[model samples]
Target: MTTSFIARTTLAVAAFGALALAGTAALAGDQDFALLNATGYEIGELYVAPAQSSDWQEDVLGQDVLSDGQQANIKFSRDEDTCAWDLKVVYSEDNSSAEWSNVNLCELSAVTIKYDADSGETSAYGQ
Candidate 1:
């Protein structure tokens, strides 16, 4: 009887452990991608659109300005836009980062940004 009880207890613990690990994996898989800004600009607006689409999705206002060393995490979804292609942004001193779905945004070949201080010079970067 003692051996049987011990075996049952061990099995129960193992089952619980498996459930916990499965839950963690599910949560991780659902996570959305985010853009990290370490510059001094306070983001005013953010936009995202597919590479093949001409329409851009305007993210809601109110974002944390990425200070020289601060970071913010955003959530995104493809259903929020019309094109459902990729991601883009138009920010100012007030807005900071835009979070969107469509993993292709992270894989952009180049990103262009127009800065006010640089007389509207467009800066580009690769993923």
Candidate 2:
């Protein structure tokens, strides 16, 4: 009886784990991507909005800061059908900002933001 109980519990746990993985797969969408900060400053705020949007959305980073050479996961629900996105970052050290537009999140799963304070320019690279 003890062996049977253990076997059933193990099977149930395995099934639950499979369901959890399926749910996670279903939640991943084209808008989900990794955001890498190669900028020379700590990012105090990060915003992502559809390219066609007139105004930037709420900061995706919230209270968290993305330090230089760090990465953050930017996820969107499966219902997000938009592919082209705009990104903006605000620096923590001086509050200077940078922006990128028309990034295709569907074709690119990762993005890196690079900044040059010398010329005050911002650029993005992705794969």
Candidate 3:
């Protein structure tokens, strides 16, 4: 084989590899997810953080409120290797909050906030 032919083939292979990596990155956050508010009050703050992170990131709501019985899209840049995440929501009425730890964002697409009116307790589940 000619040297020129081998060089051209190597360049083509490299280009193909770069394109494959780009395609994989574009698939991040492909599946849609939402948060359902069932706390019997408005949610004043919503936060999502990686399970390994020590501090919570910014509030996703940003002055918006998720009213009772309302569902809002929870858009995030999902890491392919990490599926666990933490979610927190604070109520507008009394500043009471609920949190979920090590919630798997990969398998679960929706998170519902559950409240017990009788016990005055709040919790969350992923589905």
Candidate 4:
């Protein structure tokens, strides 16, 4: 009888552990975001902000991540600039990294750092 009880207890603990691991995996899946950039340019810096707020939350600069042919939907807004644009990016496959210094994407609603893409390309709404 004692051996049976021990076996049951072990099985119950194993089941609980499995459940915990499954829950952890689910949470981890939800935590990732897509990191998109322009076609030619790699990601030099990234910035993010809350949904309703104007202040931008800057990510670590000079840390290149997005490569060519890769896309991600990172968080951004036009709160800093007067223009209200939707910031979208696409990394070009031709470039190794983007020019972080000269590119001020504040005016673009959706900025695409293309390898051969022009710097002065504007969106419809001046974003």
Model 2 residue runs over 4 Å out of place are 1-28
- Where does model 3 exceed 4 Å of error? 1-27, 30-32, 78-81
> Comparing 2 and 3 by TM-score, which wins?
2
Models 1 onward score TM values of: 0.39, 0.72, 0.71, 0.31
Best by lDDT: 2
lDDT of 1 by residue, 1-127 (tens): 1233222222112222222221112122132434444333545555554444556656633454434334444454444322123444434542333333333332333232323333322222323
Give all candidates' CA lDDT scores.
0.36, 0.65, 0.63, 0.31
* Tens digit per residue, CA lDDT, model 4, 1-127: 1233222222112222222221111221232235434443354444443223454445423355666556645433323332121222222232222122112223222333333233323111111
Per-residue lDDT over 8-116 for candidate 2, one digit per residue giving the tens place of the 0 to 100 score: 2221122222222211112247568898899767889988887668988688898899999999998785364566666777778766666666666766778777765
Task: Identify the leading candidate in terms of TM-score.
Answer: 2
lDDT of 4 at 30: 31
Better TM-score candidate (1, 3) = 3
Stretches > 4 Å off in candidate 4: 1-33, 60-62, 72-119, 122-127
RMSD of each: 21.5, 19.8, 20.6, 22.5
Local lDDT at 91 for model 3: 70
Question: TM-score for model 2?
Answer: 0.72
